[model samples]
Target: MPAAVPLADNAVRHADGQGHAARFDAQSTCAVIVTHGPDPALLQQVVASVVPQVGHVVVFDNGSGGVDVAGLLAGHRRVSVMPSALNVGLGAALNRACERARELGFLHVLMMDQDSVLAEGMVHTLGAALVELQQGGDVAAVGPQFRDARSGELAPFVRFGFPFNRKLRGGPGQRVSCDFLITSGSLVPVESLVRIGPMDEALFIDNIDMDWCFRAKRAGLSLHGICDAQMAHSIGEQLLASRVKQDGVIVHKPFRLYFIMRNRVLLYRRGYTPRVWIAQDVPRLVLKFIGNALFLPARWQRLVFMCKGLRDGVAGRSGGLPG
Candidate 1:
């Protein structure tokens, strides 16, 4: 086994071939990978893609359930693994990564999910955009466009709406402003992150990005998506195409709906969610509930869990899933 360089605050270091150590501080940027029960093979691929682009890489495992993350990343000199004993949820894990990044002196953090594979030059592209945007605006963060791994279709950036949400579409190599950007593949400045505050761990899993984007907008910061900077990612376990509708539907596991419904309700209750989104999303949620109840194999279980999620959200309950 190669030697591991121990750093302050529970960080392990690996040395690049040039004997250049990771220089994490106020002047440098680091990549933080927050993962759950991810495929070790895919996670290793993701780490390899990022290690060459950023100053260093930190993997925060949110209960990966016995995957030897340290072993998977064993030989990489630029990577460190922080494994959790149980699922702590995405927001909390990312926050922990951010805390560690700050402690190690990283001024910016590029956040990504374990399965997200970056295109070549993605970090450099986003970093360049961040520098350019910050010169004239309060750029909270810049994110890459997501290309679905299975379908090869690009997901458009979102825009705020009432009754009708809009997609911000751009041609190749274009940059555009957007209302929301998923946490995965987002490059955020530490100073702006501090001002916007840590992610709402209360939501636990779902809709955390939207909540943070709304907060950033309220704080007069702009979020942008670089059209050419792409990430190969998947939104759900399965994607079902609507035979007649233009849009496709992503199918998550039954229990996953709990976090989705609960988080949206909580966001609305806290007044962080826009009235427009609430006006439109509530009806959409109802439609989703109906569709899942009718089509999903685990119909009753999903509906029951969703209803319980709604109740918990109304009751202002948050954190990891309840037993």
Candidate 2:
């Protein structure tokens, strides 16, 4: 295959034994796209959308079932694919990506999922907002609003509020402070990573972002959300509408339920969880248990996973689910 070329605007090419690892100018941000058996077309779409906005893009594949990521990214010198033979979980993968970003001398890194597509000017807007927030005080990260790719529904920015609640805040284009932001589309400074520490790899998937955000807050850093910078992403398996509620209920697969329950329980036990989330989650968990039992298909299996998740979470069993 032909060698990849440098991107526009003085992008540097750092040669590795395998191929070239592109480096961007100091002003440019490094973008990290983590993938796990992603759909080929969607991955291409996301990569294409982000490459122009950032200086370098790392496509970190967490065990992609033999997908040829390098082959897919061929001819794009600024984009490189780093694949793992086994799934290292999202937190671990992101930590690795950040390390690579720092090694490349990138001041900031934008985290993205393979499935999500960036909106027009999303990266520029997020980068601008991050810089703007940093000028004020210690800002850990800045994230964009996420819209459901399927339904075109927008998710709200979140903040911890009175009465122990995680209140959704603000509409599009409005900048606001938030308790935690999703991993996807978050622009985090390398300095903050050094100060706050890497993601909690043990929890693996769920609540890792929240844990990081809470730690940043504890370290006197603020997390902000820029509503104008939006990403088209997926939240859950499905959205179930109800006449009694203004917002629909989100459903998830059994495996996801395991991580969701276990991670939250573990976070609470470790004192990493904010009181507000606990207050809100406790009642939500209770209702979820009942709802899944009464309505979801494969009811018994779902219950078993949830129970196992709770048990393991309490017992502090982590690093991929036990067989």
Off by over 4 Å in 2: 1-27, 162-169
Q: Model 1: how large is the Cα RMSD against the reference?
A: 5.6
Error of 2 at 258 (Å): 1.3
lDDT of 1 at 251: 89
Each prediction's TM-score versus the true structure = 0.91, 0.89
In terms of TM-score, the best-performing candidate is: 1
Instruction: Provide the global lDDT of candidate 1 against the true structure.
Output: 0.82
Q: Which stretch of 10 consecutive residues in model 1 shows the poorest summed lDDT? A: 18-27
lDDT over C-alpha atoms for residue 272 of model 1:
59
Reference-based lDDT, residue 263, model 2: 84
Name every residue pair that clashes in candidate 2.
Answer: none
